[model samples]
Target: MIKVLIVDDIPETRNHLTKLLSVDSEIDVAGTAGSGEEAIRVAMELRPDVIVMDINMPGMDGVAAAEIVSQRLPTSPIIMMSVHGEAEQLRRAIAAGAREFLVKPFSADEFSTTIKRVYERELGRREQLQAITPAPSGPQEPGSAEEDHQVVAVFSPKGGAGRTTIAANLALALMSETGGRVCLVDANLQFGDVGVLLNLNPKNRSILDAIEGGEPDADLLESVVVDHSTGIRVLLAPPSPEGADLVTPTYLRKIIDLLRVTHDWVVVDLPPALTDHTLGIMDAADQIVVLSALEITTIKNVRLFLEVADQLEYDRSKLRLVINRSDTAQGIRISDVEASIRRPVDGTVVSDGRLAVLAVNRGVPFVVSHPEAALSRDITRLARTLAGEPSTSASTEKPKKGLFARR
Candidate 1:
């Protein structure tokens, strides 16, 4: 039987929900509370299988209390009920660790079904996480280090340069090529596309979760980071645009440091502008793959950014210039880009408009869905080159000093 706790500010509503849930033979209304504070106290005592909560309450609001309950009794899933079905309300509830949301006038059947569904989903998520996490082996021995612990930041000076897309695909490609743990961090806090590209719709888990939870560490990261099908872990950006304000440069730098400790390749999809947050990521990365396109404006921005890199005292070898959609532009070719930037093009990704569209629409990286395509091959070659593998990549850099490989 699924033991449930119904929490609502209204006594009638709490009783009504109890009666509604009592209809299901498999559900047991073990407890009910009239306020958020009482709800947390009762929830802790009962430790029910699920907690159905009203979003608004006097004193401590449901979202606030739910956050506490979620941390204390993480195994017990929460279903938030709100009279208003606004997107912001739902987002708030989800960010507070709600597993499901129900509009105020939901039917008994819908409530019961939602309760069962959330329970099942949470169980499955826990099981999958257990399988992914290795057994605890205590502290590491002296001189021990994680192999393939490298940080690569995928950055661009201007927007619409396919920086996020490249970061996503490159992360997956790195995992496929090296058989290592690759984590894709969507550092574009305001408007991140990593989750959409990877088709990951996690529940209340983002980089914000780790930052807000306090000092960043591996244990904290494992809780917030979601796993991709191809064995790549992802630390997504905030759920809402305003939530980006909470993610600071210091938090981002710490996150990157902690991530590189456990992960083989930390591929950070940096924000477009040259901000403090982006600079922090650059400071952590072993290589900075600066993505540009074959457009005149894009090339101009790339040149200007390179001068900034020099001013920051960044070694030229630490940066690699990559041209996306290399053959699409009318007049500007790779050689022109190289000449304009006054640097050798380390890598190039050819465009396939139709396939790229299909991949994005389908929410799968082209490298994973269409590995045989020319686009996928280019990404794979680039991955190997960055991984320090001796491959015949079309890199025009010197043989001895090829594009700042980590290995």
Candidate 2:
């Protein structure tokens, strides 16, 4: 039940407010105060979930009482009542930390709705605060150097190729094998699935929180990146799709650069298109793990994206081609994929539909939950190769013009 405290100078007004709230079974009128001073006393003692207060009161007004309550009891949201819905009164109430403003003579519906909305928002704010894991503030490690950090970008020319799942698990595998700080970035922007795959939510706190104030810094990054129980930090994409427009390519690159300095490995999951935002991450990444499926259309797009990467002059060693669901070739073998794309497959993950689906549904990385499983072993081996084993493959092919004019 939502416990509420009603504060008003007039005895009749307080009684009427209590009566109005009494009709709702979900809300319980825990206390009633005739003045703002009494409201504070009752609020501290009762510690109600919501406080309905009059903005105008004798001796101490609602604004002053709310500011104190907000500081002392942040979880108890205050809803200010006013005689008029003027802008000035609303602004003052907000400045004093009132979560909502209600004009006088409001119906039971509006009053209850406002209280519920404010309470939900306050709960979300608390969750966001508890999720973020601040960065380490001390000096760098004894023998650490600038070249020690690695920024790996997981990309796929086609969607639904398990790019997000691979990225999330790879990050966990890296953390397990290397025992270093790993930060996973959901650069997919619009419709990112990283948070869902990891059982995390933005809760109005995402990369937008890091970039809104000004140029992002290590301190800002510390505030927005959330910590997982497995010891990996995640930078989620914006909560909504339209919020993607506010994140420019420059800001994305800046955030990537900042993360590389603080983390041993920064894994960024990219979208399927060839947009500027994707290119910015590609340019900043030290290695790009391109994911492909065992299907005809997926192989075709992979070929085209490789052509684009060649035109952009990405070094062959920088690109690692990995085929997902390789066990279900269905007359299309791995050799066909290699010959079709004219590139060797660096790694391949077997198709285990049951385990993969179960892992995703349970929001646990297979590498952590079932380390000895085939899928988990595959990802762990790949992680070790990327972390410790350097690739010897180099491209002898020449860059062809007009593959992508923009490049």
Candidate 3:
């Protein structure tokens, strides 16, 4: 049974919640508290699987109580209840380490689902930590290679360059080409679109769970990631931007180190900026695919990124340049783009605006829906190249009924 602690200042609210939760056979009301301070004390004693606390409690608010409880019992998940759905409240709740948030006047179904998801997520995290606590042999040192795993980071210095789209498709194609041993990480912590692109529900569990769990081992990392239908394991970003601050560069490195041990290939979809977090991932990547469009501004940003890569002494051979929308009739040839960036274009994905939009909206990748389309063929060939297999030239087939074919 799932043990839940409900906290609210009002007696009626607490009783109502308890009654609503009691209808579910799987849930048990472990205890109830009238204020944030009382809730913290009760939580410490009860150690419930899930804590549902109201945000507007007198004296001590839900945010303060949540922060304390989270620090004290990192394994237990907190669900913040608020009447206001403002962004600030959501941010505060996430900052206080609440795993889930619910607005007031929610249905019984919503309440039950939130409790169960939080409970299961907490249980999984604890079990994972216990399973990987390094036996009597002691913890393994860093840089100890379990096996040879390739890490690929898909990046773009400019936003709207379709980096997330390319990254998702590349992961799918890699899975298809390599017999399904691929992991895709959404490193765009603030606003990652990988979950939306692949149609995955990124709630309750994310990369933040792994990082906040202290030290992540292979089992811990595996437990946090969600497996997609395309045979790709996804480490989704935090559900809100406030949760991103919890993930530091050091934590990301540790997560990647653990992930590389379990998967054959790790594909990271990065944010547009080269923050310390992004740099940390790039430092571990075996290959970096830089994406750019045909626009002058995008090409300029790519050139600047190339210069920075040189300054950082990155291996030029490991950095591959991909020109998205390569077939656009923007008067600027692919050769001109390469000349501007001072690097040869390793791959090019043809433009298919309608298909791309449709795929994103329908939560299906074009590579799966339109495998025969020119755009899909390009992604497939690019995947082969990244996988160290010989790839044929881009397909010349034009997708029928192409509209607004610009990246």
* CA RMSD of all predictions: 8.4, 11.4, 12.3
Which candidate has the highest lDDT of all?
Answer: 2
Local lDDT at 123 for model 1: 82
Measured on C-alpha atoms, candidate 2 has an lDDT of 0.82
Superposed model 2: Cα runs more than 4 Å off: 1-140, 390-405
Tens-digit lDDT track for model 1 on 1-407? 99999999999898888888887999999999988899989998999999999999999889988887876577889999999999999999987778899998989999999999988987886675444333323222334355436788899988988888889889988776666677899999999988888766665789888976667767878788886654678999998899998987877888888887777788999988877788777866778899999888888999988988786656777788899998798887899888877889999999888988898887778887788899989988888788874222111221221122211
Tens digit of per-residue lDDT, candidate 2, span 6-60: 9999999998888888888889999999887898899999999999999999888
Decoy 2 TM-score against native: 0.64
lDDT of 1 at 282: 80
Instruction: Give Cα-based local distance difference scores for all models.
Output: 0.81, 0.82, 0.80
Colliding pairs, model 2: none
Residue 86 lDDT (model 3) = 91
Across 1-407, the per-residue lDDT of candidate 3 in tens digits comes to: 99899999999999999999989999999999999999989998999989999999889999988877775566668999999899999998886778999999999889999999888877776564334222322112345344446778899999888899999989888767655367899998989888789766544668878865676666767777886644567899988899898987878877876787767678899998877777777777878999998889999999988987786657787788999998884889888997887779999999999999999997778887777899999998999888764222111112212112211
List the candidate 1 regions with Cα displacement exceeding 4 Å.
Answer: 1-144, 389-407
Candidate 1: pairs in clash? none
- Looking at model 2, residue 228 earns an lDDT score of 63
